[model samples]
Target: MKRMLSLVVTTAALLLALPASAQFAKPEDAIKYRKSALTVMGTHWARLAGMAQGRIPYDAKAAADNAAVLEVAHKLPWAAFGADTQSGDTKAKSEIWKEPAKFKEAEERLFAEVPKIVAAARSGKQDDLKAAFAAGGGVCKNCHDNFRQ
Candidate 1:
């Protein structure tokens, strides 16, 4: 009984030490993770865009908070695009796996532009924030047109 207890404790510790990606037992889990991350990123991006486009009254603090959320959320979904995740309930196109270089380039473009948007939001200039937000949206559109369903 003592030997069994020791083995169980060791297994639990090993599992806990695994990387987050390594903990996914099914491709569906990765798909779900990426989808959830994209949803959150979209929510934040929409809020920022509303302010930039004048649809929503611009609050400097709210803009900054939303942009900060975008900065972090944009970095999350990419890691979940592991092998076999493409077969699940993801809108990610097969081009992501077939033309990985192109897909990565598109992803990199958004990552690069998001920081500029964040900076603009923190700059307290509405014009700069609007321009940056539009640019970031363009990057997102390009990637979606190419890589997403």
Candidate 2:
């Protein structure tokens, strides 16, 4: 019994010390923190999109839950991308600052995509949802391709 108690205490201590984002910190730990959080957001988004697209069937509660997470995480990764942070582990390019208008458009596209995904998930329809998510992802990919390395 004493041994078991010690093991349990050790496990709890370790779990408290190690956050989910621990593996993803960059040198300054900005983008890494956001991306780690974003990854959590993305996992749900992919599931809902897959279901919405018909790879899996719609699960209403799941859609709601995942949508909730994605809504926030969608906005996080961009905050860390200031002019001072133009290097290392980022998909961001110098063009982000150079062609501000185009970058803004890309950002807008992603913003637009998230709401639609949420709407579709809320509507509880599987049909055409996958395509919607893929289109949203395209916005993300477009930005990442151009800006992030």
Candidate 3:
């Protein structure tokens, strides 16, 4: 688990270091990169969600750790959604490219919510974490429902 977390953190750091114009050599590479990033985000999210929904024992330390990982992982996937990546081994819908502005707005909305979850987790309040998690997950569902297949 530590190894996987380290790998996710390393990958997130590398992706975040790239310039805005960074382009994958092939569309498949972009798809793979985004999918990997999203997988990492989802893994962390599930852990937090489980705690929030009472399915798992809520440990303040664990919640904070997962939220911190999520803070980085959440930002990693958006950069890989290049125009050329619309068609590939991805669940991304065509609307993502065709309606870039709307997609970006949705992305921005998600970005806006992540910090709240981070703050709530760091506060060591399970109720706060639950509220923030619900809000953030709603934003995620909006994006997934509209932009993913």
Candidate 4:
């Protein structure tokens, strides 16, 4: 039994370490990757919020796990907008490039909010998580709606 348990633990660790995708090799690639990650992350995050809010059923653990995904996903959006990063399938608006300062300011706002969402999600505090998730998620949507293609 102990040997079997050890094997299971080893397998789980290996699976967790699997790389999700190719690393960005250039600035443009990085931007493209970040945009993609943001969208995918946003989709999952929205579903997570729904679950947390009981727009779907409440699943505390699931919500917490989804929050973990956001922790990384949340970091990519702004990084993708760097001068070297551009030309992608994203809905990212030219305004991001046109007004670097303002665009970065918006990104800053998002960065500021994401940790709070992660915290609330981790806390398993339903209401707090929901509120933070809404705000953090909103930042993403707002940016996508305006700047992303």
TM-score of each: 0.83, 0.69, 0.84, 0.69
Query: Of the candidates shown, which would achieve the greatest lDDT relative to the real structure?
Result: 3
lDDT of 1 by residue, 1-149 (tens): 99999999999999867665687888889888888999999999888888889998989999889888988999988878876677767788898989989988998898789899899988877788899876667988888898888
lDDT at position 135, candidate 2: 63
**lDDT digits (tens) for residues 43-101 of candidate 2:** 87788867776677677787777778888878766555555556677655789889878
Index of the highest-TM-score prediction: 3
Residue pairs in candidate 2 whose N, alpha carbon or C atoms collide under 3 angstroms: 53-130, 90-149, 91-147, 91-148, 91-149, 92-147, 92-148, 93-147
**Cα deviation of 32 in candidate 4 (Å)?**
3.5
Model 4 local distance difference test score: 0.71
Worst 10 residues of 2 by lDDT: 19-28
The alpha-carbon root-mean-square deviation between model 4 and the true structure, to one decimal in Å, is 7.4
Off by over 4 Å in 3: 1-21
lDDT of each: 0.86, 0.72, 0.87, 0.71
Report the Cα RMSD per candidate: 5.9, 8.5, 6.6, 7.4
lDDT string for model 3 (38-78, tens) is 99999988898898888999999999899989989999898
Deviation (Å) of 74 in candidate 4: 0.7
Clashes of each: 0, 8, 0, 5
**TM-score, predicted candidate 4 vs. hidden true structure:** 0.69
